[model samples]
Target: MATLAEKFGLRKASGVGEAGWGHTLIVALVSLIYFLPVLMIIFTAFKPSAQALSVPPTLSPTSLFGLIPDQFVFTPTLENFGQVFNRVMVSGSAAEPTGFDVFFFNSFFISSVSVLLALVIGTLASYGFSRYPLKGNDTYLFIILTTRMLPAIVVIIPIILMFRTVGLSGSYLGIIMLYTAFNLAFTIWMMKSFFDELSYDVEDAARIDGSSEIKVFMKICLPQVVAGLAATFVFGLILTWNEFLFALLLTGVDTRTVPVAMNQAVSSGGRGTDWTLLASIETLFLIPVFLVTFFLQNHLLRGVTFGTVKR
Candidate 1:
């Protein structure tokens, strides 16, 4: 009887240990799955052209001794990143010059200008919607949202023609206008929700103190909705920075946006199809977005919810 009891106790301990080990293994596998793409991009970015195109894509391998051995070969080089930054010389218009310096400035200028314009205009539009509440306002809101739902590609040709007629084609103004229109719906809707959460009494109190409408908005409502504005600005900035379709179709040479330039680079297909270079460019592109979010992450979350509650 004593021997049987000991065997039973040992079996139960082994079963519990195995279950715990299995759970840990599952968690480690899930983490690896999430991290694999990031690892691949980083690895690919530094691979030499020949190795980059090599069949079976040697990402990671360990030797028999459980170490990455020197004999376990891989070609590594920074030339791909160099090419992405600036190509020495490539003939033809499609193979035109590409410099991170050029496209970065264009992207920054267009995105900043567009976001500023949208914030100003969209805020005013949202305030009006919240304050007035006139008949057909619901219809108007629907119309605004509907604008964003339209296929941007479908209208690109017409917009290009319109810009040409007005001498705005390929110009900064043309791109800004195109972006602002597309982004307006989201900004207005988001801002309106934030505005709706604020008490009407606060504005009424300001007016009673003889504050002008503009003054009230500037001094009172503006402070209350600063978080919403920040959120909107970030959203708008991301949209404009990453926009490719309109930038590609609308802008020419000097005015081309980063994504457009990147697309042009790949499409031209000389050293253009180089995935290592593509990976480096993508890394550069993503860094700004990552930094902005990382730096202001706390402020953004807090600001977006300032006037959200009814109290």
Candidate 2:
């Protein structure tokens, strides 16, 4: 009888061990190369503003001429983070809340609301497409997908004109609607695949047992696709959170998001770009995305593979 490792295909072939080690090393190196920029941003965020832009671009926080006398340690300050939130002192007085607070709130609110709307609408549409046959359904799906394929720039001018005509320009509702529309295509396509993978027996049985269509869909179908919903929510959140072009063109000062704020935060009144503060903003900006992905990582793994295997 074969061992469990062989049965599961987990055992390495006898001649390939050295080659596998080489491949692993190559992958590790490539991953580090891609991660270096993120490491740079994190390092710069903690450094003093002067050292952040220092010549020769040292990654170490300490200098040879430091007070600690060549020790590799330097004090990391929260001043950069404070500056991001407008908490830094101004001429010995405490600073007031600048628009950064508003920017942060706007980003959170818009991204959350838009993703929720997209998920709700897209999930329903996807279920209909998966379970209910319509004439020219594939053609309709292809048409919806074509909207995503078009470059945003190609549509922006017309969308802007339409929004202005409808008095939707610079409004939260307008941006949210736009984001929902953009995300809807992706959500539907992704969720439809998951729904297609489900067995129809359960749904059919529920229907035969006097369950209404709404009750069967709500209580039975939706529960089984939780993984897909989590995955779709994360993707939709990311698409809206990092979007800059639409927000920049469509939103006013009152509704600008963090990506727009990051652009404004880069310059400091003709004193060149404030690299440290920008790094601070980027570091904070990554937290919500990171947290969401971290929490849903297991669901994401299952979601992406949900339909690939057959029992």
Candidate 3:
């Protein structure tokens, strides 16, 4: 008994035809629960010290009601954010800039370059595996998947030593390559699934029309899985962005990343953490990630398909 408009999602009603109040309520509750810590970081970034670490903590009780209580009431300040920015921007070594700009740049550069490289290469590898009848390919894929299962701790020492010997430690090229290696396992598998979802007819037609193999791949096939690529790229970017262990172990002054710098702040002199400053940096760190995910969410959820291929 639904209208055409409702069926197409162009129009909605309050009850069964559209998302009901119960569904909306469930989703909201789950989102709030999942994002509660992030909410804390944002609100705490604006709270003063005495208020931030008060006996009960300003944001205590953690319920919606508690968030609106008198203790949560405070004059927000930018002092903490300013302090951290100044700390990052001005505190660089002559040889290895230590400023906020350097850390931000290093993180952005390494993650961006590595993810792009991984997307290009991983998708190609996935395509090859999907289209070709190479023997033992499933076993090969399983091995590749196993690489992702290895604990980072077990491999850290070897990676560190290898980088040190090659003089790649602390270099952009080094981190980018290392990240590409780490990301390949997941990206390859993910791309393979997406490519498999498409029929081989498009590529075959292109090839029959005298298109080269590369052209068939680039022009005929890649376009159909755009949504999958976006999702994979987002996944790869997040892995690289949030990477801490290798970045910390292998990188030095010149190439240290945000996560490393954040840890250094908390570890400095063993004094208790700088709460306000920590919260401020955390909030700023969240912006790029949030925007990327939000923009790509549509593509990620619905994905794309080139209408059904003819038999």
Candidate 4:
């Protein structure tokens, strides 16, 4: 009878002409190592506190042989999720709203608004740059890239002062505009590359057919770069989602994002961190990001590689 390994063509080094399996094994091992922390997070978030902090760390062993605790069969509970959702927004007030809900909304609103702004402003700028061929074009692009490359801390003080002058500090509008402005340069550069790769013959033909410029752009050019739009949109979303320094410095209590909230939760009191609660919030926080990546997976690959190769 064929062995278990034999059925799937798993082989030993004894073969005369077969390729070695060592590389495959190494890759698999590295992959497992990389996922170990995530596995621990999943295991910890669902387990009860006792189980989550078990000595020598049970790894969620549920069943026991003689003294062995089996890890696979523990009952799951939604208490941690409930705790996160039910956290008091105002600690010392009569009207105690839920904190996580507000933070979640802020994160969503900021990311979404910033994405839209980047798309509109960046796409237009990219299209203009692609079509206009301005003098010192490379220098202009380099300058734009420099803005994105600079650290948030470098400009935080000046921005705060600027915001204070216009009454924009610690407001949702402030953070939204900040995120949009921060990502705008990268978006323009990326979308410009996509535009540069496109042929202008179709747009020219549309214009010669008496189509308006907007119509030509909407009908002929925009459709060709859907992948770029999706990729750039996703990048914008990620940048806003993960942005910490500016969010921390610029956000008021009402406008705090999930990342800031999570940091506050972990950094609260300074006694120690709540690993269980932290893990739960973090896992839930990542759901939207994961969903975005999953839904946009198809376009991301193609768009990210837009100008890399010629057809």
Best by TM-score: 3
TM-scores of the models, in the order given? 0.76, 0.84, 0.86, 0.80
Q: Which one wins by lDDT: 1 or 3?
A: 3
lDDT of 4 by residue, 1-311 (tens): 76543443445433333556897788789999998988788767776665666566766435555454455455566677766776544457453334889999999999999988989999999998998878988888888888667677887889988988998878999999988988898899989988987877767888999999999888878887888998888887888898888888889999999998888876676647667777888788878987997898766644333333355
Candidate 2 per-residue lDDT, tens place, 110-167, comes to 9999999999999999999999968999998998898889899888999999999999
Candidate 3 lDDT, tens digit per residue, 166-263? Answer: 99998888999999987888889999999998877777888899999889888878987888888998988888898999998888887899999988
For model 4, the superposed segments whose C-alpha errors exceed 4 Å read 1-29, 60-75, 87-98, 269-271, 302-311
On the 0 to 100 scale, the lDDT of residue 168 in model 3 is 93
For model 3 the local lDDT of residue 276 reads 78
lDDT of 1 by residue, 1-311 (tens): 34432433333333434457789999899999998887777777777767776766666533446565544446667777778866755455343346667787888888888888888899999999998887989899998898677787886878888888998888888888878887788889999998988878888989999999999899989888877887888887888889888898888787888898877776674654767777777777777767876776655645433334467
Candidate 2 weakest lDDT stretch, 10 residues: 8-17
The TM-score of predicted model 2 comes to 0.84
**Model 3: runs farther than 4 Å from truth?**
1-17, 60-69, 88-98
Q: How well does candidate 1 score on lDDT at residue 166?
A: 95
